[model samples]
Target: MMESAFTRPVARPLVVFDGDCAFCTASIDRIRDRIRPDVDFAPWQRLDLTALGLTEEQVENAVQWIGSDGGRASGARAGAMLLRRAARPWRLLGTVMLIPPFSWLAAVVYCLIAHNRHRLPGGTLACAFPGPNRV
Candidate 1:
């Protein structure tokens, strides 16, 4: 639903990230470096999430990935989807997530990070909202 610079009709997944969070930005940068050149990455904050039927609270709570058919994945599912799109070794890593124990572990980790992101060192006060000081 979010618009991106690289949308293709050929059916590839898109990653929607928190652009304002330094940690999220860094993670996305790493993912971009590893993924196939065609995968799409966009800032959820900059895009019109409401148009996408996603609330700001939802965007702030977790990373999201929209599959080719418009299905949505969140948290660890989103992470695995991203790795699967990266090809080969990364795909292998993503596949490991399908295992029950590992999948649960990944989900727990993702939830922890997502819930406490704002308290993390590089995550504090990193919002796209304009303050009163802005002209």
Candidate 2:
């Protein structure tokens, strides 16, 4: 049986993403396939950023994570945390991503993609909404 969102014994990390960004959505989907089933997926657009203790500007900048203890992590740090929550090989990859040079590179890559995602194949204005119109 699937676990209840509130009843899962372990504290599930929450991934706050851009619901309108096709690339971000697809990336989250891929990450979901690799991570623990308990992790939560929430769109920043649909959620109250303040409730998550995040500012609107921060959400627009990058994905964020709300830990069980209410600690926050953003950008590559958040990505690495999510990957580590996944199992095995992915965990190894997350570890590598945490390294100095690799982490720095990952952050830059994330920023570039985030800034230019609208021009990518799956990215378009329609992706901002949920419907068949999305690319």
Q: Over the stretch 55-123, how does candidate 2's per-residue lDDT look in tens digits?
A: 866876788987776777888888887787778887888888889999999899877777777777788
Q: Mark the regions of model 2 whose C-alpha exceeds 4 Å error after superposition.
A: 1-10, 34-38, 126-135
Evaluate model 2: give its lDDT. Answer: 0.74
Residue 13 alpha-carbon offset, candidate 1, angstroms: 1.7
RMSD of each: 5.0, 5.9
Please report the candidate that would top TM-score against the real structure: 2
Worst 10 residues of 2 by lDDT: 1-10
Error of 1 at 11 (Å): 4.7
Please, what are the lDDT tens digits per residue for candidate 1 over residues 98-127? 678999999998888876666665666663
